[model samples]
Target: MAANMFVVRQTKGTVLCCKCGILMAPNPANMCVTCLRSEVDITEGLRKHATIMHCPECDSYLQPPRTWLKAQLESKELLTYCVKRLETDLIKVRLVNAEFIWTEPHSKRIKVKLKVQKEVLNGAILEQSYVVEYVLQDHMCESCTRFQANPDQWVASVQLRQRVSHRRTFFYLEQLILKHDAAVHAIKIKQMDQGIDFFFANKSHASKFVEFLDKVAPTKRRESKQLVSHDPKNNSYNYKYTFSVEISPICREDLIVCLLELLLVWGISDRL
Candidate 1:
């Protein structure tokens, strides 16, 4: 019988913490023990230092330095361009943050998680939030074929909490869904029930509208479709296709829009 073994030796050298200016003994990755412990801080320093700014209108701290924010905005612009370049039935594109939290001392360095939503449809959840890094959430609308003219329109209402950031994101995503030719026709929005009611001209329109809604819906682990009824006075059959989504709260708009688009497209295809 034979035994195989190896001897380990410690190499001595001075490693300095990028921050705090502390000298430490040699270790793995050329980082000092203390620096290694505070890896996130060290990485942040390596990147740009974010500044915290206050908004007089809202009295809230804005994370990420102005420069960093500008860069991020520019990146988003680039993404929009790229999405536009893709030749598909997809009419809209959006980037959403799921969970955004401001740590101590308002620096532009925000803890942000991101997601992407595409087309959507009925009985689907469009937006979702989770405490994780970047995740992808996408949807596609079913192809629209038959369209009716001059149908009666009705409004759907829901309540939403008032918050500038979330509100802005939601509106932005809605506009994106509107970009679709089929989803755009005969659609209107009104504020009611603490949220907003999205109106459509007919059952088909409402079905298409729900598709767009799904795109912006949140992500959910277990989602099931439910059928909701409209008033009997309209002289037409009315129903709503509903579903649940799970995702990070910050990126809800994106998920909702994506789900809506998928559902709308699916409905159209089903009719065909």
Candidate 2:
């Protein structure tokens, strides 16, 4: 009984490798781990060629096809972007090291050497290095496309009109907006009679601007919307919003004058 059990164990435990013709323990691939790895490539899904979205006008790469809030002009970011685009569906790929092989800005061809790692069996990782060639294709982003088509197009407008016509007040407001980056979404700024107009492609941006103004200056605001266009098939409504913001004319310097004038003329001032 013991001799028969030993034979059964040997038959089940070992396999003849088809490539090397070596007798070894059977693994998931019906061959030894070493032979299986050698015969089959671990980087089968990894790509050798890639195409990156490049906008010549903006000199920016299209990442995820949206407005990138953060700056991605660094070499590491650009390299990673190309690698991700090439190996779209590859899983468990860790970048060990990356080196630029050749970069031709004129031809728009960038070759990079990427040393990547992947897990195989029993948590054992395999590292392989490959030279990936990236071809930068001219693809216009949404913002650039819109600007190229028309420069003066906007979706919403912030009509800030104060009671007094003072350019100093508008200058102060511009400084605040620039310091806090409150108008990051504003595509264009147009100087109006008493105040500056902030134009945005999104209504939420106009709403954010209004919120920022409320914190800085106590203002009375009235909003109105006009139907620009509507798509019945897509069930989408496109409307242009106008935010008329009127800040209090009584500033700190004019506070006493306003109160005294109001009390003298209109019986009594509520603030006083």
Q: TM-scores of all models?
A: 0.24, 0.45
List candidate 1 stretches off by more than 4 Å.
1-165, 216-248, 252-272
Report the C-alpha lDDT of model 2 over 93-196, residue by residue, as the tens digit. Answer: 88778777755568888888878787775555666777878787888767667966997567889998777745555667778976787977776677777777
Q: Each prediction's Cα lDDT score?
A: 0.39, 0.74
Steric overlap count per candidate: 81, 0
lDDT of 1 by residue, 195-246 (tens): 4544443455655555565566542332223344556688564544322222
Itemize residue pairs with steric clashes in candidate 2: none
Top of the candidates by lDDT: 2
lDDT of 1 at 257: 88
User: Alpha carbon lDDT of residue 36, candidate 1?
Assistant: 45
